[model samples]
Target chain A: MRTLLFLLQKEFLQIFRDKNLLRQILMAPIIQLMILPWAANYEVKNISLAIVDHDHSTYSQKLESKIFSSGYFKLADYCASFNDGYKLIEGDKADIVMEIPANFEKNLVRENKQKIFLAVNAINGVKALVGTGYLGNILNDYNGELRLQWVQPSKISPIPSIEITSMNWFNPGLNYKIFMVPGILVFLVTMLGSMMCALNIVREKEIGTIEQINVTPIKKHHFILGKLIPFWVIGIFVFTIGLTISRFVYGIIPVGSIGVLYVFLSIYMLAVLGLGLLISTYSDTQQQAMSLSFFFIMIFNLLSGLYTSVDSMPGWAQIITDLNPLRYFIEVMRMVVLKGSGFHDIQHQLIFVIIFAIVFNGWAILNYRKTT
Target chain B: MVAVQLNNLSKKYDKGKIVAVDSISFSVDKGELFGLIGPDGAGKTSIFRMLTTLLLPDGGSAVVDGYDAVKDYKAIRGRVGYMPGKFSLYQDLTVEENLNFFATVFGTTIRENYELVKDIYVQIEPFKTRRAGKLSGGMKQKLALCCALIHKPSVLFLDEPTTGVDAVSRKEFWEMLKRLKQQGITILVSTPYMDEATICDRIALIQSGKILSIDTPDAIVRSYEGSLFAIKSEGMYKLLNDLRSYENTLSCFAFGEYHHIAFRDKMKNYSEELLKYLENKGHKEVEMMPVIPTIEDCFIKLLKN
Candidate 1:
């Protein structure tokens, strides 16, 4: 215990002395937490649209106003010819072009049906898909209103109408930031904790300090613990900072107990810091450790269900997430913060994380060679 | 009793394609000052590392202070003090912190063994507030030695501690090591410089992962197989060329102000004939005579053998 205390003291002293590392741990991550969620939103909006109208009738004008009023698109320009609309798209003035046929209103009123053609820039595939889906919803509402107007007020309904309503529980407003902030917080903590511990030992190796350390009587387990405890404390401190920012800046207070979040975080950091130490043990230099850590972080970011629903992914991707440590924390964060879930609700995930902590840290401790 | 004993210890790199330390065996007596002298890549550091329990030998065994290196590593680690070839102290930490850390790890305090390191530590004490990395090369060497001795271990291993130190600091470091020897610490120091070999009680001359000779410095010098002669000429540039032309000249090498030469067979009147030889090669004002061999001479002779 005395040996570990001295080791910890030395480590903490070095950490506080380095201005760059101190800023990275305390200041940079907090700033990232405040700003990154604003950009991470996936809600498509402010799509510039151009319209080519060959028909100047009430029905066509009403449909045009509906698309603009839906808040998904903004009118860039109105063109009399397809050539003019094509020019607007090519000139970067519009994201999509809509064309109405000459007899669009006449056919809609007489034949009871008319199709409007659309051309969209598909360079950014997600924006194009969501914009088209919003357009489809607006048209559906217009058709329903037209059918209701044609039906006589006093006439008996020919068929029984089934009015279906969707009440989105938990998140009624569908604010993407509320869904994203907690997940982003978990990501930052895991990344900072792992990367710090990963580079710690490798930096010692590069600077020749590990030779001085290895020749001492310090036990391997004590050394590993001393290295991990400081970063573990930093991880919790960062998480608290992120939570306070979420409450004041983003108004995303956890519906469940904050204590429960910290409880899970304390254990989760063990797995993260262990994984970093494991990378360090396998590498002979800091550059190698950083490269390997970047590789694993990229994989974790993609498959952790932070941005997208994991169930929506392919079977192979879902299988890969089973091995990912980040996936469980993200799941628990969303459940407890947004869903007001308790420990009973996330017991399985907690158990899995406990297993991960033991395996990852145990593997790291074993891989570190004292006699190479 | 022996403080350290090795039996055919060996280590190889790149899967035995490169033998870093060949099967070499030697021992240092308790409280004896032993020096391992060799050039770079001569396996000096490799042998020190293995004996200090920082590296495992591929074959053979070593015991330090009544403990096997492989099995009793934990016990051995606490009882041995090692100063590596490179500056390994924390660059961000002050000198005092480095000493305190090492002392604490060994379950002792600097206060407990103040006498052992006081002579060397006092030299660096004025710079105790300075970061070890920021100090001069000589100051860093003294701080490293101080930290190594802070625990008052029975055995000490220093690997090329004076490689980059200036001449004055190198002399002071050797003088400090002699003082440490008087306190009954078994010191095994390695150096690439041949001149440092003379100060040790016994020395091992090694090269290319093998030991060339192991004995007292005088004994090693006396074992030189042939007589050596030092010659000088005003045409020193042409002197080396002219001396190799002599039929009886066995070896010729330029040493500082003169060229040391050896004859294949002992013969009289050769120096006289050599004078005429240099004069014919546009040489003038030549001086030639016999001189005693230094450690460098013995090393080169063993290398040639």
Candidate 2:
């Protein structure tokens, strides 16, 4: 116990003494927490649009007003030719083009149908997909209105149209920020815990301090615990600061109890720090550790259900996420914060994280040899 | 009693292509200050690492403080202090903090072992608040020594502690080591500087991962077999070329400001004959005289054989 205390004291002193590292530990999460939520939004709005109206009829003008008033699009230009609308897209002035046929209103009234052309710049697939969906809804509403004007009340059957109502259970506003902030918080703590722990050990190797420590009477388990505990403390500290910023700055108040969040966070840090130490044991230099940590963090971030739904992933990829601690933590964060989920809701994930911690930390200690 | 005993200890690298420490045997008495003198890559650090239990020997077995270096590592770890080849102390820590940390880890306190490090700690006492990294090279050396001695182990390993230190600090470090010796600690120190060998009670001259000779410094110097003459003259470069070609010169190697030459035959008046020959080779203001061999001279002689 005394040996562990001394080692912990030394580690904390070293961490706080380096001003640059201290700033990075405290400042990076704050900055990223504040900025990433706003920029990483998936809601597409203010899409630039160009129109080639061959039919200067009342219906075409009405369609133009409808597109602009929906607040989903900004009209870039009104062109006489498809070529002009295409130029608007090429110049980056517009994201999509609508070309109305010459007899759109005539066909609608006489033939009971009309055709229109749409060209979407698919470079950014998400923006294009969302914009098209919004436009389709508007056109459907217009079609309904036309159907009502042409049909007489007496001719209409004595039947009612089906009505469907949707109420988003947790986030009624469907705000993407609320969903993303928790995941980003998960990433912040993971990067801080894993990268910092990895570099810490490898730095000792570089400076030749590991040899000095190895010659002491301290056990491998004691040393591993000593190295991990300090970073685990810092991880919780960073996590708290992030939670506070999410609460005050972004209004990401958790629906669940704060104590529950911390209970999960503490164990999650253990798992991440253990993996960091494992990388440190395998690498000989700080550079190698940094690269190896980056390699793992990159894969974890991509597959952690951070940006996309895990349900859409292939079967094998979903199976791989079972081994990823970030997946469990992110699920836990979103569950408790957004869904007011209790411990029972996240019991399976909690068990996985605990098991991950034991296996990783145990492997790291076993691989660390007092004699090399 | 033997403080450290190695029986045919060996280590190899790259699947035995490079032998770092060949099968060699040596031992140090309980209170002896022993020196392993060799240049870089002589496996001094490797041997220290093995004895300190930071590395495993590929062959043979060694015991430190009556504990096997491999199986009894935990026992040996508590009894040994190691200062690695590099300055391994935490650079961000203050001098006092580092000492306190090492003491506490060893299950002791600074007050318990104050006497062991007091002589060296006082010199850098004013800089106790300064970070170890910011200290001068000499001050860093003293701080490392203090930390290594803070626990008062039975045996201490010092690996090239004075490699990059200035002359004044190097001398001060040796003085501190002597004070440490008075405490009756068995010290195994390694250095590439041959001059420091005399300070050790016994010196082992090593080259290429093998021990060439082991004896007291005085005995090693006395073991020089033949006469060695220090010769210098105007146009020294040309003089060196002419002397190596001389018919009777057995060995000629540059030693700082002069060339040390040995004759094939131990005949009388060789110094004069060498000077006459240099003069005949158009040398001017030539000088020659016999000088006593130093440890380096003995090392060169041993290496030749």
TM-score versus the correct structure, for each prediction? 0.97, 0.97
What are the TM values for chain B, all candidates?
Answer: 0.96, 0.96
Error of model 2, residue B3, in angstroms: 1.4
- On a 0 to 100 scale, what is the lDDT of residue A352 in model 1? 89
The worst-scoring run of ten residues by lDDT in candidate 1 chain B lies at B264-273
Fraction of native contacts (fnat) of each candidate: 0.88, 0.90
Write the residue-wise lDDT of candidate 2 on B36-154 in tens digits: 99989999988998999888899999999999999999999898888887898888999999888889889999999998898899999999999889998888888888888889999
- Candidate 1 C-alpha lDDT tens digits along B1-305: 99999999999999999999999999999999999999999999999899989899999999999999999999988889899999999989999998988889888999999998999888889988998889999999999999889888899999999999999999999999999999999999999898999999999999998999999999999887767899988777778888988787878889999999887764554777777777777888888888889899888878876
On the 0 to 100 scale, the lDDT of residue A251 in model 2 is 93
Please provide TM-scores computed only on chain A for all of the candidate models, following their numbering. Answer: 0.96, 0.96
Model 2 steric clash pairs? none
* CAPRI category for model 1: high
